[model samples]
Target: MPDVEDLFVEFETAAATTFRPPGVADVQRRIRGRRRRRGLLAGLLAVALAGPASALAVAHRADRPEPRPTPSVSPSPTGRLAVRTVTLPGVSGELAELRFVSARAGWALFDTCAGADESAAGCRRTVARTVDGGVTWQRSALPAVPDGRVHLLPVDAGTLAVMTRVGYLVTMDGGNSFASHPFDAPQAAVRRVFATPSGLYLGCPPDGVPTTCDRQRVLRVSGGLHFHQPPVTLRSDAENALVEGADGRLWLTVGDDDGLTVVTSADQGATWQEMPSVPRAARQLVLAPDGRDVWLVRTEQPNGVWRLAGTGWQPGPALPDDTDGIAAPGAGLLVVTSAYGGLGFVTGGGYVEVSELRGPLRTSDPGTSVSVLPDGTVVAQHGRTWFLGVGRGVDRSWLQLS
Candidate 1:
């Protein structure tokens, strides 16, 4: 206590080394040490910032629930996905088929039962047109009532063809007048019909005549006026699939008791080549948007889809149900599960749930089919409710068109 300052100075001198200015090397070393300390601090800060997210992920994994069933008619969460309702003028009852050749021009096939009995026998199958993006519709009368199922295949904004059981009707003047064309093959042998820019293709009896009547041939009708049999033939009498890829290559898949046979025609069915045989009996064939990958819907596993790559068939994504229809809307793959599940957007070989479309609309009923327009607009119908999927990415929404 008597010599406190002197004692402190003595203690400092005992512990401290000789006082000298640090050199450039020492300064560099000190800076490097500071940089290391900063890096360590930054890493610690990152970990601290990520703690909540990591915990959330772990909690989510632990508390994850089973996949929910397709939602019923209920309001969606506020601001999660936007929904808009459209008014269809002069159009009522259930829309069976919807086809759009352009963004603004489209047609809808519906059963008109206004002021009549609700039975199918009382209802009349009718076709309607919308030239202003479905804002308004003009009902047109068909030349004859279809005895069975019919399909509307639009060739252009003005020219459209409707395939009925007996034959097909072509309207080159926007439903002003329809010209009927009967099938060259017997009505029973005409199983399916496909349309391309060139004309129509039909799955009918081989050579348009029946001998053994166990085989089918791909019938091409150029200009919708004549029937020409392509070179390719199928051994299956049950059913066959004919699809035109984006590259104008036609792929046909035939399933029989043995297995499946695949054939491709690059020259509009002028010439054909058989591809490697597929073991699974595929019930349907779907061409990818790129026109190279071919998808086969197997009869064994109806919900499962197989992708044909270079030379082999690999397992692709299994859809929500067998009723789901796959469509490429120029944004990504979309699976129209409206018949069983709701709408599913396909991503990374799986489904990214968009919306169940269960908002008091009948978009989830059976017999609903989905089709993508030429402008990438996805459309579907279930009962009288129609859904239009507009926008892309995050802005995409399933709008209910009444």
Candidate 2:
């Protein structure tokens, strides 16, 4: 009988070669088929170990099997960004989180579950790296299995970090290996992780429960993964939205007893200057691909959207009622994700809908998301397919990626 490690190596190779997202029905069939093969392998291994050489020899005859599984900045010719699909080698399943440190290098976190059944026990947490844009990918092993959604923070081309309810995972040599770090000091669940030139910051709540994190407490780490509370003070009792500028400056919105206010910190989080308060509370902050513009999105009823101008915010036209999240493809335009399904591009004082792209980013499909690359290209994920949004206005189209 072959070694246990060798058996798994063979199984993985066969699994990768057999799984591909050709269509909805095809993916389901492949998943079911792979599960059966895995079950057979497990049963055979059990029987072989249960007895002696005789059982091993008999189990060898049953061999068979298979299976497996960013935004940019520039405005295109038509006033919006154009997208061209770049097939990723060795990648399948919907992207749970996609982040890029540069135009050429990035990382993605996804699972092996078929369709929208992410709660399935078979959904294995998988991570992949892409160096040549999103053209190809290299799979990496995780330090520990994630409990829920893992936040992807790319420090550079090779260094990156991921955080979940458990703690932090850091990889200096890309994703080759990851080292675990505990979330002890803060003693709260890390909902958001941000990377800046100064270091890494984690947004943690007072307690582990509650859907929204109040208190405006941020833990900053410089050289090591040790998270300590910074000297900076925030006034918000609600949730705060944070974003880093091109010049390493930090901008965030705070909602306190006085209402909602915008603030910026140039010297890390030591100090901040509060701007004029806005009418609505913004839940998310997005910086443009070029990093020259910032937009605040309020997911509440009216779907309020605002662009930073001087010290105040300039309100854009109201987004659709079903708006879930927003991303900036360029300096002035926006890509809005709908709760029903699909995306919308805000341009020419109005918006154009991309009906072909299904799976509403953060709402109906919680796994789906949209991001702009540093080069101004908009990338979005639908069910099991990834897409790059290219062209502008009517020319805008989605190119499917692996």
Candidate 3:
């Protein structure tokens, strides 16, 4: 018989010669396409060794689809939340994202199996709207979203901005009577949409590979989804992380997947100004409850967390080294990781922790995550199950998410 070691050596040589891992740019492009899968192995690996908050920044590169996973609704004696089930009409997958502009209005995005069953390659997408909070949802008419991935933005009580392959869809009278406008020929592919107090903007990354469409630009739309003159300076196909400030100005964070930059645009995307305070190599960006900049820097080990205060950056707050996300979850507060895979809200003085978790907390689990909705509701996940913020242990009450 042939030597076993020699046969293994020969097979290893064949595999290495035939296979190669992708470079940073390729990974960035794929991240954009598969953002809805909850957590791709590569994305989780990026979070593991990439620094404290790289996961938060890179995770925003794209987005999710799935049916609503019903969790056990045992009454929480610690808080006022009564776990509940949310059903989406014709939902064939899991809920990718959900947000409520107020206690009354909200939206959800879903990612489903491409062909009746889930696929490793990609997925199908859908959107649902709710006027009486998240308890029930109905399909919202949208342009046939090829990948079912979309960015949903609430402009006001009666307005919303949606970006999909069918172009930019907007509803002025709530979810009823949505209007779609085709993007200018070169800017048709929808990358992202942001609804700011000043106006809403859509990111249009150039099509083609890095060799061809290597530039990325954003379109400013108002009154309707019409393109304004002049585009933003970001020139990569990777989706940029964006946030709006109370001043009606916008802050954008873009990266090469290996590093990130934060820039500001006061006159919309027509002009931009780079904020040098942010670390050039840092990948994570968080807009604090006070509208200040918070960051996780680049280090061999992610042990430091900083927030910008006045002239210099200072240690922002203390969180477990395993902290995966941060958000302003109402009450002049921030939702942080609590002990035993639970959560806490950081207010003016100290941390308000959520203790005695009865089940697996997805936000603390691998690949799963938590984020604060526009209204400061903290939503966490372990798998398909979701937990919404109700009342706090101190000075809070169970929410009426009816």
Model 2 agreement with the true structure over 1-402: per-residue lDDT tens digits: 224333333222221111111121222234345555763222110000000000000000011132110122223333333243433356655566565544557777775553443245545566778887677788886755654434555555676656544546767687899877654432211212232334433333433211133333553433233243333354232223344555566665443333345677767666777665556555445666445666666655545777878777888765766654466766477776555555767764666666455323334433344555545555565554556665543355455554
Looking at model 2, residue 157 earns an lDDT score of 65
State the local distance difference test value for candidate 2: 0.47
TM-score of every model? 0.60, 0.58, 0.58
Off by over 4 Å in 1: 1-97, 114-126, 141-153, 162-169, 180-193, 203-214, 223-236, 257-259, 277-282, 299-303, 317-323, 328-340, 356-364, 391-395
lDDT of each: 0.45, 0.47, 0.42
After superposition, candidate 3 runs with Cα above 4 Å error: 1-78, 88-97, 108-128, 135-171, 178-192, 200-213, 223-233, 265-273, 277-281, 289-300, 330-333, 337-341, 346-351, 356-366, 390-402
lDDT (tens digit, per residue) of candidate 3 on 316-389:
55444444345544334555542235555554554555543334453454333445544444555444455555
Q: Is candidate 1 or candidate 2 better by TM-score?
A: 1
Candidate number achieving the greatest lDDT relative to the actual structure: 2
TM-score ranking, high to low = 1, 3, 2
Q: How big is the positional error of residue 132 in model 2, measured in Å on the Cα after superposition?
A: 2.3
Ranking by lDDT: 2, 1, 3
Error of 2 at 276 (Å): 1.2
